[model samples]
Target: MSFDKFVKNLSEDQKKELLMVLKESTDTDNKVAPKLVPKIEDGSFTTSIQKKQTEGETFGVPVTEMPRFNKFEDDGSDHKDKQNATPDVELTERRRPPFKKITQTCTRCDNTVETHPQFYREFYICDRCLKK
Candidate 1:
């Protein structure tokens, strides 16, 4: 059945019991509650670009000169240098251990098994409880 229909079918006593269970499971005084307004005042957050622009500073370097490279002429000197160079260091590859699965117990069943916790809320109820 749909959640709304199931909830509506519950008696007054059942509803009160569910509410009591939920209230007991949660932490009412959590410090991570979201703020309604920003901590800083208006126009307080400034970026580097905005600061530089305000001071009339240029953004990037001017392209006044171009780079030059030497022309390649093969005289077998590079090959001779490679042959003369000796191995200074050795490198070894490392292997990591395989991941192991973690198991959690269902709060309702009190058994050691994988359990799905409620999203955006506290409490773990196994598949058996969920079906009910």
Candidate 2:
């Protein structure tokens, strides 16, 4: 018989007793199994590790923080002074230029299309021409 049918046939007291037994078994199993610790390191994949001789405490290489840059006060150019300058501000995003969409003309057909400028120049063809 299917498990659902068997469960349906069981009395209320029997179901309660079965649940209690199952819960106790799960609790025991959890207690028996050792909890795994994730190994977190720079440029290393995160992996679950168990207690073993090979999984002993490892010395990590100390990483130096990026040097903070301060604007030259005595520069000849007069720039607006920042009221609240944070040293821990990220430098990457501010340095990057925003992407602008590029427009291209289809060589096969006299059709104009807008496309992002790529590193390698590619010939633009209209979708209708490409389908043919």
lDDT of 2 by residue, 32-66 (tens): 98877765676876666765544323334333443
Model 1 C-alpha lDDT per residue in residues 9-128, reported as the tens digit of each score: 999999999999877767554645877975566776874454436333344645445343446788876646767887788877668765554466667887555423323123556578
Question: Scored by CA lDDT, what does every candidate get?
Answer: 0.64, 0.73
**Residue pairs in clash, model 1:** none
| Top candidate, metric TM-score | 2
C-alpha TM-score for every candidate: 0.21, 0.27
How far residue 123's Cα lies from its native spot in candidate 1, in Å, is: 82
Error of 1 at 53 (Å): 53
Single out the weakest 10-residue window by summed lDDT for candidate 2: 55-64
Best by lDDT: 2
